[model samples]
Target: MYEAVFHVRGEGPYERATAESTTRIDLWCNDHCDLLSIVGDGEELVLDRIREAVGVSQRLGDGDDRLIVTSACLKQHAEGYVEQYLAAHDCLTLPPLRYENGAKVVRVLALDAANLTAFYRDVASDYAVTVESKRELPTPSVDAPLLSPDALLPALSPRQREVYRTAHEQGYFELPRETTTAEIAATVGIERRTAEHHLRRAEKKLADALVDAL
Candidate 1:
């Protein structure tokens, strides 16, 4: 199996909403409406903008840290062409679709590499598309660990993951510490304090997961 993460920029309400705020919106389409879990700063402002964009919204729970809501599905709003195209090509896009920055990051799976290529070509024709990451997985063993990264570390937000990854790659955890928080912040385009905050959160989450596993 082949896995590819595609960053797609479009005019969909979710995409537009995330573009205007520093929030991340994860989407799942239902038969009648779309289910969304929104997180990050300025969620209230983003939610209000989304309500204006989609016209109808029903908020679930208090939505202080994580907001769960339902709105009109993209298919009903005539903005589901890319989804339809992916379906036609037999590419499965794993949900919830992640909307960050100005694009929707779609994690797709295809049995054949050619199918992935064709799907990317078709979608890129209508919207801006970029492949953020692609990798071929080895077949899982029967004795493989039950806790995958996705299953074990759901608490780390997108920003936390990015900051942690940046720090790791730059050897911030090395014996001599090759990189500083300021350098990581500059690379990630976030304020140093903000980067440090995310890194600390990520490290704590990772530590907790590891200790629990042990």
Candidate 2:
């Protein structure tokens, strides 16, 4: 498997605002639409201008100083175009476009070298693309692990896996902790208490699997 990253500061009002403003914006796309998360140095904050700037069509709050925004690119911009291009090439975008000063750094996972090469070639026509990094990842699908993930399939329930993946990917386990259980709850579209309960259950199941392997 190959993981590739690119940094872009293309033309868009929102992209300009993000580059110029103190706030940081990160976005994730679902092939057809997008999910946005924005943060700023705490002060008198306003999102209405951001909404206009980014062309955000819908929003839901995750509380804890976060907003989950949904948009289908009300304006022709880099993000929407990138998502479409990746989807066309059958590539999976690593979630959450990282932003600083209005330019975004996004990661993409390609199943093969052929597709990865195609993606790079196609995107260059539109953006001032630069390969920030590339790495060959060991994978069970392409390569093989001594212990297959299939061995632990029964270790956790579907609900357990769902919550655990969300928690892990959302940086719940990061040092200087970036998110709370309640915030994760909102991100997974579940209740806070339910998220906490499942996270514990998932952890225990994973622990048990590890112990069994040992």
Q: Please name the candidate that would achieve the greatest TM-score relative to the true structure.
A: 1
Would you estimate the TM-scores of all the predictions?
Answer: 0.74, 0.50
lDDT string, candidate 1, 61-93, tens digits: 443246455566656765776678788889887
TM for candidate 1 is: 0.74
What lDDT does the true structure give each of the candidates?
A: 0.76, 0.64
Screening candidate 1 with a backbone cut-off below 3 angstroms (N, C-alpha, C), the clashing residue pairs are none
Worst lDDT 10-window in candidate 1: 145-154
Total colliding residue pairs, candidate 1: 0
